[model samples]
Structures are given as structure tokens and as C-alpha cells.
Target: MNKFVDYFKIGPVFTYFIRVFRKPDPNAPTSQNLRMMHGINRISIVMFLFCLIVMIVRACTR
Candidate 1:
């Protein structure tokens, strides 16, 4: 459990997930923003799904 939490870097990962689920703040710096750029939401969604799948697999294997 500690290893998995460390692997995900929980703080930042949770922040990013929350930002992606909520509307992005317009005043935030462009570089730090989580909103999709160039119509690439699909890519972000896929990556998120992949991460979830990896976590699920690790849990099951353990």
C-alpha cells in the first residue's frame, strides 16, 4: 500500500484528477493548467484510464 501510494505520488496525482474533473481555473498559469489543450481530451482520458487499470491490476495481483 505504501509502495502504491508512493508510485502514484498521491498528492499531485489527486490534485490533477480533481482539476480534470472540475472546471479549470482560468487565472492559473498555462504551464500548470490541467485542462486539455488542442482537443486532446481523449489522450488525457486514455492515460487516466490506463493509470486506473494499472492500479487495479496491482491490487488484484497483491
Candidate 2:
């Protein structure tokens, strides 16, 4: 939806993270880069949270 797109439309935090972790096309504009970078960040964040939960459960059991 338009609202969702507008919400995550390349803010300062996204820009910095993309600059460091994602090799976005320099020629491409921010809007195009935003969608791609958002996907990449979502996947990485999910994986990080999943791993953190697993570690915590493991430590508690041991």
C-alpha cells in the first residue's frame, strides 16, 4: 500500500545501514534502493533475533 511504502521510504537509519551492509547501486535513486535495502535488513534482523532467542533458551536449559 501507499502508506506502507511511504512509511519506510529511505530514512536516515536505513541509509546508514544500507551504506554499510548493502551494496546498493550508486546510479539508482533512493526509492529503488529503499525496497531492496528494506528486504535485506528485514531478513538479517529476523535471523539475528532467531539466533538470539535460541542462544537464550540454550543457556537457560544448560
Candidate 3:
């Protein structure tokens, strides 16, 4: 969707790494970045789970 593309400009994998160590910036003018930061973090969690499942399946089959 165009909305998704507009908001999440960063690719899923890169966003995952960036989200890992981000602390909230309280001094910022608005909470828009805060919301996006949380979104990236959520995306990272999902990606991590998907990768873990794939790794587990590959290990099982080998």
C-alpha cells in the first residue's frame, strides 16, 4: 500500500537493526518520531521471530 511505503521508508531488515538500540528522545518537538520508533521496533520483533522459525526448520531437516 502507498501508505505503508510512505511511512516505512526503511527496508524491514535495516529497520530491525536500527530499532535495536534506539532510546526515546524526549526533547524532540513532537511524538511522531516516537511512534515511528516503536513501529520499527515492532517490525523488528516480527522479523526476528520469522527468522528464528526458518532457522529452526532448516536445522530440523538437516
Candidate 4:
């Protein structure tokens, strides 16, 4: 379906999951890198919570 294709085409979710599971880059040795890492961590947490809320709402509505 077009919706499924579109979902996978914008690969942010997949990339986020990969980043969540992958080890932190040992070569990162700067304050900017640390800040970026924190940002990514926060984004991932928010995305996860949003997904959880959506699923709960859908289930309740059904």
C-alpha cells in the first residue's frame, strides 16, 4: 500500500531505532558531540512515548 511505502520511505524511525541500539561512538570527543548525543536521546524518548500514547488511544477507541 502507498501508506506503508511512504512510512518506510521516510526512514527516521528506523534510523532512530538503530541509533538507540547501537553503542555510542567512542571517537566522539567534544562538547558538541555530547550535546548531539543528548539531543538524540531525548528525541528517541519522546518518539517512544508518543508512539505509546497513540497505541493506547487507538486501543481505547476501538
- On lDDT, the candidate that comes out on top is 4
My TM-score estimates for the predictions, one after another, are: 0.38, 0.50, 0.51, 0.50
lDDT per residue as tens, model 1, 1-62: 98987896768866655555665467866562333462366477778789999999999999
For candidate 2, report its TM-score.
0.50
- The better candidate by TM-score, 1 or 4, is 4
Q: Taking the tens digit of each residue's C-alpha lDDT, what string does model 2 give over 1-62?
A: 99999987778765665565656577877686778777787788779879999999999999
Clashing pairs for predicted structure model 2, backbone only: none
Q: What is the lDDT of residue 50 in candidate 3?
A: 100
What are the clashing pairs of model 3? none
Q: State how far residue 40 of model 1 sits from its true place (Å).
A: 1.4
Report how far residue 17 has shifted in candidate 2, in Å.
12
Model 2 weakest 10-residue run by lDDT: 14-23
Q: How many backbone clashes does candidate 2 have?
A: 0
Window of ten residues with lowest summed lDDT in model 3: 16-25
Sorted on TM-score, highest at the top, how do the candidates line up? 3, 2, 4, 1
